[model samples]
Target: MDQDQTYEYRGYRLVAKPADNGARCWAWRDGVPVHKLIGCDVPDAIQRTRNAIDSDLGVAARDGDAGDAAYTRALEAVLPELSTGQLKMLQARYRAPDRIITATELAKAAGYSNYSGANLQYGNLGKAVHAHHPVDLPVRSNGTLVYTCALADSPDLEPSATEDDSHWRWRMLPSLAFALCALGLVAK
Candidate 1:
């Protein structure tokens, strides 16, 4: 029974009721209806359904795995600043429909080492975010299910000196006054 379950794509769901007779049709993961063959002249329907199923399974499996891997990386990155409970809190808050999760949120929720840790060295905290390595899990809460977890851009990878370019900063102590002012905060 796909009822009460979320497919999150193609709008597939279980439909117990049927329009023509008692012949129910699966959401086909979308508006399409999945049914039995009526005649040889009504060809290609079964094969097409099979193809859709296969394609859906293939993509879901691949993407799901990658999301798991990326999460591993994210965990490694978050570990430096947050306790496990905090990390879980983030998952509970984010990773649902209409929510756009980002590295910054992960860092904050996990108590990242600093404000910009999401885009800095020692940020990735892992080797890499391989494709299809993350498997997004749906957690049940208050009888509600939602999507959580993401996979991509290894959280373990150190922020290289290349993500940002052409934007640079420079400073100058044009006079002794400026130098003294800058050093005012230093030890006497």
Candidate 2:
């Protein structure tokens, strides 16, 4: 077998390599294998890997559409209420190479000198949205507010001895991303 080629796309790390029949690819998040595919060729394998990742992220609809109508409407309803800083943070997350961003990175994107400002605004963003629509949002067992849950997916990580906000990461929800595009907040 030749050396495996790794590619990062939309927050997933894809590894592609040769197989007996043709090629194989795997999608990984935070170093854990989440999905796999076998293709007739290397490029096919890579494309299939990307498709799987996008489908899991909800960015790629299995039925050849952009998003679910109800979910997109729900996100659009809350988007108008987001502050400029929060919107910028979301845009930054969407543009991130791997689509994952930390609080400090979000602060920088939102023009805040400190992460605290971003943190506060993010929490408020989530609180407001959760107050109205409580479905499909991630919940934490610790009772602490995980603001990222409202609009983003958190990295899959083992619970550490101490939870650190500075190290936390967020990836924008696909539904929200599509809504943002529909609302002209970002390009489609």
Candidate 3:
């Protein structure tokens, strides 16, 4: 029952407290108790707490919370090369996550009156995606597609350091194509 004792587990501070049945381990984040593992001994409770923290962190990373900066940088690197219409469509698609973006919807967002204009804009966006992202993004028959901003699928697309600054260079060249392929850039 000593509240003073605490142990760090998976970047979380955990405290083991004695309960009537067994010991309960509580994990704290930013000094707030976030998780609790009851009906276990100190070691088991600690392990459970660690597992919970690891799972939470993994989910956060996958959900675009942990790697937001890297994702933003990757998108920003290709932003300049995109046209105004493509940029507008991309922004609209990104805003609607987990939802299918249709050509009509894209056209409306891009200030186009007809679906054909939106379809053309979508084609431009597809080319941009292929040139910059180089990822296999599926498009449905209705021109419906789900756009994810995270670079989780493209692990080989890493940010390389330069002599001047530690920024990711987005310049695509024929010479670097071989290297990029070797790094699984061309692989689906």
**Backbone collision count in every prediction?**
20, 1, 0
**What tens digits encode model 1's per-residue C-alpha lDDT throughout 95-135?**
32222234444455556654355433212322221122233
Cα lDDT for residue 125, candidate 3: 47
lDDT per residue (tens digit) for residues 92-170 in model 2: 8767754678888899999999888998988887677556555444457986766556666665463222367765776
User: What TM-score fits each model?
Assistant: 0.29, 0.58, 0.34
Model 2 pairs in collision = 11-98
Cα deviation in Å at residue 18, candidate 2? 25
Name the regions of candidate 1 deviating beyond 4 angstroms.
1-100, 113-115, 119-150, 153-188
lDDT of each: 0.30, 0.68, 0.48
Residue 12 deviation, candidate 2, in Å?
Answer: 14
Candidate number with greatest TM-score: 2
| lDDT value for model 2 | 0.68
The best candidate in terms of lDDT? 2
Which regions of candidate 2 fall more than 4 Å away from where they truly are?
1-67, 136-145, 158-163
> What lDDT does candidate 1 reach at residue 182?
29
Superior by TM-score: candidate 1 or candidate 3: 3
Comparison by TM-score, 2 against 3, better one: 2
Give the alpha carbon lDDT tens digit for every residue of 1-188 in model 3: 44534798667899877565545788998989999985233433554566568788874221222222333444456656757776566555434332234555667778888657765655554454445445444465888553322221211245443332122222211112222223333321
Could you tell which candidate, 1 or 3, scores higher by lDDT?
3
